[model samples]
Target: MIASTSASATIVEFTTSHGNFTVNLHDETTPITVSNFLKYINDGDYDNTVIHRVVPDFVMQAGGFEFTGNFPLTAIATDSTIQNEPVYSNVRGTIAMAKVSGNENSATSQWFVNVTDNSAGAPALDTTNGGFTVFGEIIAGMDNVDTITELSLCGTTPMPDYTAEQCSDSTFVPGTENFVTIETVTIIDSTVDTASSLNSVKNTLLSTATPVTPTPTPSSSSSGSIAWLGLFFTGLIALRRRFR
Candidate 1:
């Protein structure tokens, strides 16, 4: 019923058979990935789809294999594939786009979530598999993630239709006799109202952009001159203040 994910707090809720979980899409960081995923959401293509593949303690994936009509596997339709935007690491709870080997920009509909932190190796998943794009992150209902990950697999009984070569996680089942079903996925705009706070932030940024460099005062070696300069500036200040 779910696969996995984000930044502006676009909370995407996934109501599944096991339970409901929420993810916030990282719209600013991974724009291409988020836009692509949202296309599927807007089309309602992911609704009723089963969480077909589950690798215990690794990841739980969906959005590609659809179980319908006699409850069989049917290839889900997808729009044009999107470029890989793997900005975030494949850490636990982050959802990354799934793609075939060697094809970096082949990510279409399929996605996965890290049950465990898969961020290891020399370059790690950040530079591996054409960089799996992490577009969102689970914000709530981690219990549902646990429930999906710990589910029993079909083992040798349920192979879904595709050949072993085509699908890698074919043996995965959501649970015994029960597959996780994603009822619907909706986005929640949790954008912070910065209109009021921006005034302070703008002032801070302005101060940072240009520091207040103090004007150097003349030394006492020329006490008379220094006093005259100070008096002149004081008069100027008084005049300026009078204008105000």
Candidate 2:
């Protein structure tokens, strides 16, 4: 059964065959995109789906192929595609809707988890692929996302161009029935109702609790370059002052 997306979708939980991970929806930022995604969640469209396409160090894609036992199948009929809402950047751990190369508003259910700062691929997704809607980020289970990205390949380089909803052939998961599966998607409420909201009577002093922020994964190559540049500038300043 599909779980409810009724609560604050910001703390959406995904119980996968691999492990549990959570995503924080940008509901405030991308309302329409988040709404569309919630519809899929509500209808159980993504249940039992497999990570069909794995682009190492780039993305861990799923929500396309479904399965019964070891056999692969296409997902149930999807709702109409939502308009492009490309407000957020495709940085690491961010989850974005997927679409074909030429079509812009063709996304319906398929999505990807970016394993790296995909700014280099932004042009293909944003400028070329009609800006893949980035509506959420993985607040937890990013390690699971990383694991999915490192799964064994079923085919040789280029992956056989196998994009036809679902394939029953052993082509999808070649050697074993071990491809990563998104077992379940559930939205858990993390909101704390204050005494005031609960009852008009207040007896004790209430302190506003700070919101918990998820630690973001560093952009390896880019962040490292910036660190190196800072060190270089610091050394340059020290050498110039000593010589003077």
Candidate 3:
């Protein structure tokens, strides 16, 4: 969901099928864009949206499609396209809004995750380029994005002309189901409570946890039995010597 312009550079939480990601929204530069986006998020609009287009090492797009898995056919049905907020480049892990041909301001619901830094591909003001609006960036769980980027895409090249809402027929490079789906998108106002503190603790615990290993109790008992057996053998030998 998009957030209000007044929102703190809040840490938004997206619980995806792959994993959870905390994104820091860039509300300062793109207030209107962010507000529009957070509106749908607050309204539960982006939930269950399929990552319809997957350009490996490039970007994965979603959010324009319906919650029921259908994309709007008419241009008017989708919200008005937003003007280019190109202050932020198409850097890796940045979230940018997607728009149709000839309508840069018409970016309503759909957005894309830039898997790689495509600063050269940043939407330009001239007619030749379509500048993608970068509103926020992924703060955590980039491994999930990397995993999705490495997944098989429908195209041979990393950048393809496939701009549809959903690409079910499009095959992955390795024919694997690596498509990213939005299980749920939640706007977390960091000003209210810093939830990322818990994430840091969790990461620390994961890093310092005890390794999984079997205890050596049985091995110690066997060694003790062997020692007793050796002592018994030595005593018998001494007894035999005495008898001799």
Q: Candidate 3 lDDT, tens digit per residue, 48-141?
A: 6545444455566667542232222111134445566655666677787765444446567777776665544222211212455677778898
Backbone Cα, N, C clashes tallied per candidate:
10, 0, 15
Best by lDDT: 1
Q: Could you tell me which residue pairs clash in candidate 1?
A: 1-51, 4-95, 5-94, 5-95, 5-136, 6-26, 6-136, 6-137, 7-25, 7-26
- lDDT computed for candidate 3: 0.49
> After best superposition, candidate 3 residue 132: deviation in angstroms?
1.7
For model 1, give the 10-residue run with minimal summed lDDT.
235-244
Q: CA lDDT of each candidate?
A: 0.56, 0.54, 0.49
lDDT tens digits, residue span 1-109, model 1: 1212333335678888778988877766677777778778877899987776554555677887555543245667877777877666777787888775556677788
Model 2 agreement with the true structure over 1-244: per-residue lDDT tens digits: 1233554455578887767788877766666777777778877877777666555666666776665544334445766766777766677778887764445566677777767766433223333344557777776789876765555444211122233222224233432244466778887844422111221111111122222222223232332222211101122111111100
Per-residue error (Å), model 3, residue 152: 3.2
Model 2 stretches with alpha carbons more than 4 Å out: 1-8, 69-72, 121-124, 156-177, 190-244
Q: Summing lDDT over every window of 10 consecutive residues in candidate 2, give the lowest-scoring window.
A: 235-244
TM-score of each: 0.65, 0.65, 0.59
RMSD to true structure for each model, in Å? 25.7, 16.2, 26.0
lDDT over C-alpha atoms for residue 141 of model 1: 87
